[model samples]
Target: MIETAILTPLEEELFALVNALEQFGFKKHKSLLGSLEIFEFHELNLLLALGGHGKTQFGVQSQYLLCQLPQVELLICAGAAGALSNELEIGDIVAATATVEHDYNLKFVNRPLPRFTGTPQVIDTLKQLPRTEWDFRLHFGLIASGDEDVVTVERGQELAYLTGCVAVAWEGVGGARSSQFAQKQYVELRGITDTANHCAAADFEVNLASAMFNLAKLIVRWQAAKDYCAV
Candidate 1:
């Protein structure tokens, strides 16, 4: 069984499987920091939680909570991202085989920070699933995760150039760091709903749902597989 975690309600709906929901709590920890909700489908276990922006502070906290579990296997993160590359279209999916912190790079100034990397296990798992040509395309590339919501085209391009990544999302870098410490295979998937240029006046909530809906299809499919295997 592979254990997974989603960071938001939008991500929860986007990646939930058809399993009974289980509630969990952090010991003496306030829910304001984060909550624990596990969903079980077939024999697979998933932990769904959220991470808010505060200089990756929430992520470090989440990692501490996950350490208490000591049984989580794989981590999958799904969220909305701003498209930085011209090759990506709105509502399209970008599956990350690897993730890096965009703001951590300082090689130009003689500072080198170790980048957290994910394994190929995610690609292998997706390959196990039946391949059907779907409406949205799945692109595997470098994803830059950070705090700021990219809202300018120039900023998007600059970040893309800095990280050499195609997409930008808010929380995956934190997830990547935590997952690395857990020695779990990490898979970060994202959907682009707006170009940085259009994000200035876009309805973020609506776009977030659109991305979640796109991920929901995969969730349902995984759930169906779980049910079938149980039979």
Candidate 2:
């Protein structure tokens, strides 16, 4: 049975992890979901799927993957995020214990914005991991998810204020939503590629490689340190 499924949002992001996983014998295969890229490693009964580029894309693909791969007990959302906190440096990771769907607000309709949280076991596992294995730092905080590009400091701060997030990304809420619906364990580990400032987009392009590599390296390190499938 496939015990874990890793859903990543971009081709570059997927390859960064796949390249890292190759040393452990993971290999590409014909995807059951034809539109998605799939990889498998038999010994661990692990699978990875390319979930496409945005929140909507990720939600649709992940929901389908969970339905088709019912044995998958854990879902991981991995990729890059813009830092909303001043302390975050490029290549740092925000292993969010909680996340907010900032764009899902309904204040006009008299409803509150939704927040997603939990996965304490996963947090504990990551916390107990050997720091020597990773070159980057880990920060546990709230991650804000929405469709906004968040290229300006003003906008980023606004999101940070509204959602109380340390990092902002396009796909975390969708990832969490899918896991919630599937009733599976979930966690999101995102690499900080750029600070959400005026130069955010340009900065993201410049730092993308290192951030993704570090993030992918962390995943491989985590897998080796703990048997996520067992508990």
Candidate 3:
């Protein structure tokens, strides 16, 4: 049974994690989820998949994979996110203790917002390590996801104030929703690629590499710690 799966939104991110996970002697595997790489560590098997770049792509892919592979208990959607918090610097990690679809509004229908919670088992697994083990600070807080690539300080502030998210990104909510529908555990881990501001695009390009590296490094290091594996 495939106990856990890691989904990334971009090719660069996919490869960065692949490189980091290679140390565990992973090998390519085929499935309805398309081409995937599998690695086993701490008695937990992690299959990595690329969901491409958006809520639609991520939702469709995650649901399809979970439907196809019912054994997968935890689905982790990890990638880059913009920092909405001034304290969060580039390259820091944000393990979403909760996720909210900030742009989703059903107020016209008197419906509540679509909000998702992360698996505490996964969060505790990440928190198991001491701060010194993490080269960068690891933040556990809310992450707001939407279809928009957040680029304005006003929009960033609005989302943070509304959803109580420290970081923002696209696609993670898709995974969160999909996992909720499938009745599976979910976790979203993001790296700060830029501050949600007018310069977001330029800053993302400049910091993406290190952000990805740090993300990959954190996952690998987490497994290496062998403190917990909730697959």
Candidate 4:
């Protein structure tokens, strides 16, 4: 029986991970969405969706597709994010404690304050993983999500101050919202691919591969722990 679904924003983020899974007996199944990859691991069914970048695409795909996969007990959004905090370096991972839509607001009507928290049981499960011998550090904190790519030091600082988020991404908030609406346990794991600054693009291009691969490794380790099955 399939119980988990994973969503990634781009193929670059998931390609290496998908290839690695094939060695562990995960076979792909054809999916409705042209780029969607459905894999089976033992009795577990996993759906990997390519949501593209930005909140609109992510939210639409997540809500529409999750409804089709009613067997999913846990939904995870894993990908790369820009580091908003100076404490984070390239390849560091942050398991989002909560995701906030930093761009959501109604001028003169509402302020941008909506946040979606990770499911407590799932967060606990992630916390129990062995940390010894890990190459990069793992952090748990707020992740700010918005439509715009943060590429300036000033903007990054402003966002970090406003949301108190250590990382920023395009899809986390949207994915979290969709999972929440489906009443499914949700978690987001993001690897730092760049520091949000003038050099963000070059930094991301250089570090994205490692960051994504690390995320895949984390997911594999989490699955091996078998903690998610209890959720």
Candidate 5:
């Protein structure tokens, strides 16, 4: 009875995953968390919902819902991210070994809160997934999440230097905080869609749709594993 919680921050990603879940024949029980609608797949008690950009309020609401579930053991925050390093290509997945709030700093004050960072626990469930199931390559590194998007090269490098994080995204921190505080195992799956270069790269347009689609497929695989073990 291992319940899993899947959260996406964007509507398009949520819709894609919901539709794909239906194709897998799972009926979603609907509910609302403030203004956000959450769909729970009944058989596995897995929760699905969106946490809009830097929407810490919505993320907190969603986590409260997950807390109500008796068996939720894992929390997955999956979505698109912009790459900061040259080695990463579009559509590749970066599974975070650790995560931090890169935007938090103490330059204006004596010191910031001590809770801004940590060594995230490794995701054992993701590790159990057979490597041949998907065509995506997975990298383990520090994922920097914050309220702002890393749209500029200078900002990206600065944040990376400040946090010693390899990549940055807009929503992972809020989602990560709630999940970790709730005592659930957490893992972030970021599909790289844009480079830190800022300028629209020709490859970005070609890769984004596929990255979104593939992310859905990966979620389905995760759902299947949880669904299988429950039986």
Candidate 6:
């Protein structure tokens, strides 16, 4: 069984993906968390939840879902992100090999870097999937996560230099940390929605829908190929 979490309810890509799966007999359920929405794909033993936005919410909801759905064998955190690398373009997809909390720091003492590497088995599984023909490219790399949206090119460059990350987002590291603590297999896939610049908001607005849709499509494709129903 697989458990998937996204950050927001208003995300059209997620909404479309869930609705499409519903036609295949997936059932929606009410969740205990106010910001969360639950959907079950009985045939595939898949559970989907909306974890709300931000790092804290993602971490809390990931733990809650993991505890509540102990039967799930894998956890996927999928959403949109800003490209930190010049190689990345809007609407491209990134399957994170590792995640780092770039905004985390100690007040005065030197703290170990907050980096979480995803389960290798899960990462390998994703890497082995057959590539589908799509307009956007798929990349495997590190992703930096933080509470603030990176808006300047210089800031983006600094983060990439620090973490060697190709993209940045608000919640992937939270989910990664939660999954690590639970000892659950986890993977994160982010679709690029902007280039992290002065024009980030405008670029994000233009690319968000397409990026989200593509991410959902990739998930659905992987589930189908794995014959999730039988597993």
- If the candidates were sorted by their TM-score against the true structure, best first, what order would they fall in? 2, 4, 3, 6, 5, 1
For model 2, name the residue pairs that clash: none
Question: How would you encode candidate 2's per-residue C-alpha lDDT over 1-231 as one tens digit per residue?
Answer: 778888888887887767766755656564656566688866545788887677898889999888988888888898889999998999998998987888885655766577778489989888887788677899999998888888888898888887788999988888889999989988888999999888888887788778877876677667776765457
State the lDDT at 179 in candidate 6: 82
Please state the error at residue 110 of candidate 6 in Å.
3.4
lDDT of 1 by residue, 126-209 (tens): 545664846776677888877677888889889888778888877777777777776766677787777777543374555665
Backbone clashes under 3 angstroms, per model: 0, 0, 0, 1, 0, 0
- Tens digits of lDDT, candidate 5, 1-231: 436677887776677667766776778888875666878887646778786657485467557756666477767777777787777777777878777766676686776333333334345555676669677766677788777756678987887777766677767777667776776667777888787666535544556666666666666665667568758
Whichever of 4 and 6 has more TM-score, that candidate is: 4
Candidates in order have lDDT scores of 0.62, 0.82, 0.81, 0.81, 0.69, 0.75
lDDT of candidate 4 over 1-231, digit per residue (tens):
678878888877767557656655667664565345554455335667676678878877777767877788888888889999888988899999999889887678855589999988878878889978678888999999888889999999999999999999999878888898899888889999999988888988898878877776677777777746657
lDDT string for model 3 (104-196, tens) is 877558665677889887798788866675667899999998889888989999988888899999999899989999999999999898998
- Please give the range of 10 consecutive residues that has the lowest summed lDDT in model 1: 20-29
Candidate 6's displacement at residue 159, Å, is 0.6
Poorest 10 consecutive residues by lDDT, candidate 5: 112-121
- Worst window of 10 by summed lDDT in candidate 6: 1-10
Kindly report the root-mean-square deviation of model 3 from the true structure over all alpha carbons.
2.9
- Model 3 global lDDT (CA atoms, 0 to 1): 0.81
Error of 5 at 146 (Å): 1.1
| True-vs-predicted CA distance for residue 2, candidate 6, Å | 5.5
